[model samples]
Target chain A: MKSFLQPEQWTMAAASHWLLVTTVLLSVMACSSVPAPVAELAAAEQAILTAEQARVNTYAASELAQARQKLQDARAAVVQKDMLQASRLAQQSKLDAELALARAGAAEALAVNDEMKKSTEILQQEMLRNQTGVKP
Target chain B: MNYLKRSAPTAVAAAMSLMLLGACASKPATPEGVINARQQLNKLQASADLAVLAPVAIRQADAAVQEAEKPTKDQALSDHLVFIADRKVNIAWAQAQDKHAQDQRKLLTDARDAARLDSRTREADLARSDASVARNDAERARDEAVAARTAAEQERMAAEQARSGAEQDRLAAEQARNAAALSQQEAESANAKAAALQAQIAALNAKTTERGLVVTLGDVLFDTAQSNLKASSSSHLANLAAFLKSYPERGVIIEGHSDSVGDEDYNFGLSQRRADSVQGYLLGQGIAASRITTAGKGESLPVAGNDNASGRQQNRRGEVIITDAVTASN
Candidate 1:
């Protein structure tokens, strides 16, 4: 019984070693041919530019700054030869910039709507006064 | 399911391997952050306004949510996916909110325009009312001025009439004053004449008889059987002429008388000549000839009998009679 359990334990250990080694070898081979996330980095840079053109910093300052930081981190990941992480970071940076732009647009739209409502209210009050004063 | 269906060499080996791989080999539970992100995405997708407004962003968020939901061995990769998914969902919702506000702007703009138009119309009406009020005030002022002009004209006419009436009254008063002065002068002259006539009658020693006032001239005034008056007797006859002239309303008759003892025709002639002399003297004294009448009487009537010579002498005389009497002031 001891001998049977011993052989089974040895087989499990060897199989685990083989699986680890194959995973490492495949990862190394994949890394040697993988390119930098050039398109994603460009897309993120373009999104940041669009947000700046939209004046996102004035309304969503923290969000725009986080997007810039993410872009820088993405570039660093590319130099470290971590293509998958670099791609994911570039996508996150673009989304961050997009988020900043979206939040700024919402804030500006809300402010404009508020001003329009206030103007309408003032005109309505003025008209009310005119009617009441004359007719009363 | 396929691995479970395959026959194993021993029950113990299959059972131990299943137990050892149970915690890790089973499908990984989704992370709490990823679940939250998916829930948020689901909520946004349920909204028709959000889905229509931000379709592209919603689709991107869906993709990120799916990626985060993927079973992975690397926790860091899972966490990054969850982070991106969370941001993507928020961004989509924010974009949808902005689009919604933009869409609502149309209604707000329309309302504001309507209010502005109402205000402008009311202002135009107010301007018209103000113009009407101004016109009324102008008309009132014009009417007031016309009334004032008419009143002033009436006052001017009244003043002119009063001035003319005052001038007429002044002229009448002046005429009345002139008439009163003339009447007073005539009355004074009448009074002076009456006083002088009274004085002349006293100097002549006129007697009031039954017939009239008579001034008697004695026989001594003329010479015996002569028609001429004596020079000393001329003084007495002069008073008679002045009295007659002063009382021009009175007339006098001069009568010469003689005694019965004288020759009848001779006495008559002598008496008649004596009266003629007295008349001639009065004519020279400025008395009118029509005011004097003279006659001669030869003893036709006598106051004494002819038995005594003194009686005959007293009976021969000349007399003057005044016919009328006039009171002084009347």
Candidate 2:
């Protein structure tokens, strides 16, 4: 029993090793086989990320500039003895800066989710090829 | 598994926080609402300023209201002042009219008093004139009475003078009648004396003429011897008577003679008786008695003287007187 059990253990160990090896190999092959498309996909993703970051930066800059201009108008109204108009302009500039900050955060989160979906589709194609013993 | 669990919880928490933040940020602040809030604040500030200046603002509003109401009050005051002025002028005019009426009454009273004085003076003058006329009438009546008395006196004097003249005329007529009576007596005496003288002459002639016997009786007839009528003488006387009868118409007067004797009265008595005897003898001879008147002459009327006896005888002789003559033819 021990002998039999030892042979089975050895076969299992071998199969397990084979499976590990095949999986590794298939992963390597698959990796190697789609390497240019992956590289193009990564470049497209980087370009989308960069365009989103620049849009967020532009929004942030416009909001900060409006805030700065509102503060300057407030100071000028106070000097001209128009305190009521100055306070109204200062409150409107604060609200525009907070809306620009929220739009930048939502654009960064949508780019990260697009990268995860590409990874999961590649894993599912490899498993099907192994089962059908067909060349994907 | 630990990483998945931790990351999933964290991601859910993060998603919830983002949604809440987005909702909070999405509501936009409007500029119109800010402007409305500012206007409300400005109005509140002005209300506060008005409260601080209340005393000055209220005084200014009151002054404006007083100025707007002034013209209406001024118009009413002017109308009342004009009414008072008109009343004062009317009172002055009425007083002047009353003064004029009083002056006219005084003038009329003065005129009436003067007229009464004039009438009294005229009546006094008339009374004086009437008194003067009555005095004049009394004087004229006195003058007429004096004239009547003078005329009566003159008439009485004239009557007295006429009576005296009538008495004087009666006395002169009585004296003339007495003188005529005396002249008639003297003529009668003269006639008697003439007859005696004629008888004496006649007796002497008879003795001469008759021639009878001469009886001488001369001596005897004387009274010496008593010659009275003797008886012889009677015869002689008778003879003489007879002679006288022859002459009848002749009246004879007788005479006697006487001688110187003792007394002349005795002698004259003897001569007177001789004459008487002769007359008686002649009467006896029938002679008419109315033819003869006898008277005695006495001795005073004797023609002869008485001294001698002859002369005495001559004176004593008787004589015859013829007193009347008769015509022989008748």
Candidate 3:
């Protein structure tokens, strides 16, 4: 409530406001001029590479294709200067690649489970038959 | 670097919202993609068995869902967040399921091992029992064989005993038959001897009486009054002597009788002399002297009345008595 403003304080405050304005303008310019989502894009590409390495393209081809498409779309967004969309699309691409890898792994795991189940069943049946055969 | 990129977008988005705030009076609902992502994440989180399996992935998925659920005016950004969230949730689930399946494989492996071990154990048990059964059968067979051998041995011994008993019985019967034959031969010989003795007695003209066989010699067998055996009686005396020789146990008693003539003492003396003459004749024929005896009866014991010459002649006789013939022949 007391009037504590002085001339030097006002001069310093105004100088600070100009600096702040300059900083805002610079940040706004940086935002509008779309820096490509280089890290996110690289992450997505890396995820795709990992999925391909895992042979996800063979088992989860559709998901892998979608991930590839999303990565391409992210590149297109970067070219179009839509930095936010490019980042989002890159993230989505990465997630899609991961999903493809996850799907492929799940499919192989389930198949292995089925194989084991069948093997166990065969063993059980053989045991039963052996037990029954003894009676004769 | 990524953080800076993201914050820059938020600032831009906030500015755009402020500009659009005048046109839109109310806030927008959460995007369908975000709702879908939230639903998927909720399902993943509800699974306790799956949630704990991939802790880092689940945490990432949770963060993605929360970011997607944040009310944002940017449709593209919301869609990207939703997709990332959905994929992350699905990835978490896939990873959890993979881990779960691998974990289950351990149990399955154990089960398979158990089954294999159990099968092996059963086979071993069966083989062992079979061996035991075979052993029992073999032992039983051995025991039966031993019992059979024992029975056979006992039967053989019994047969041997029976054969020996039969042989003993046959031998006894043969001995009895031999004894019977010997006795029969002795009896036949005795009967023949009795017949021969009877013939000898008849030849002697001996008479049987209570005393024994009696052979009487007429007075002519002696000299008129002298005591001497006449030669005419030699044949009859020889027969008697032969009988006495054949039966050595026979004892002779010679008695002399006379007619009522002369003095009694003189008559007795004459008879005694006549008995002595017969005994002397028997002794000459080889009769034992110990088996011969002589006695004389005077005219008082005459067999007929001495009033007639015939009666007197009948009374004047020497009698040879075989006293022990019946007893000695037995």
On residues B161-273, what C-alpha lDDT tens digit does candidate 2 reach at each position?
A: 77767766666666666666666656665565446434643553444434221223444443444434555666556655554564455666555655555566875776677
Model 1, position B236, has a per-residue lDDT of 94
Candidate 2 residue lDDT tens string, A1-136: 1221234334553455334434533454454542112222222222223333446565345644554465456445434444444444444333333333433444343343434444344444444443464433
DockQ of 3: 0.39
Candidate 1 wrongly placed segments (more than 4 Å):
A1-34, A76-83, A134-136, B1-24, B152-330
Candidate 3: segments with Cα more than 4 A from true spot: A1-136, B1-18, B21-44, B63-91, B94-162, B298-300, B323-330
lDDT of 1 by residue, B231-316 (tens): 99988988888777777877778777887866889888767777778888998998777777888877776768867878877777
TM-score head-to-head 2 vs 3, winner: 3
Fraction of native Cα contacts kept in each candidate? 0.89, 0.00, 0.61
Question: What TM-score, over all chains together, does every model reach?
Answer: 0.62, 0.25, 0.56
**Candidate number of the best DockQ:** 1
Please give the range of 10 consecutive residues that has the lowest summed lDDT in model 2 chain B. Answer: B83-92
Q: Predicted candidate 3: what Cα RMSD to the true structure?
A: 15.4
Could you say which candidate leads in lDDT? 1
- Model 3, position A59, has a per-residue lDDT of 81
Ranking by TM-score: 1, 3, 2
- Candidate 3, residue A81: the lDDT equals 69
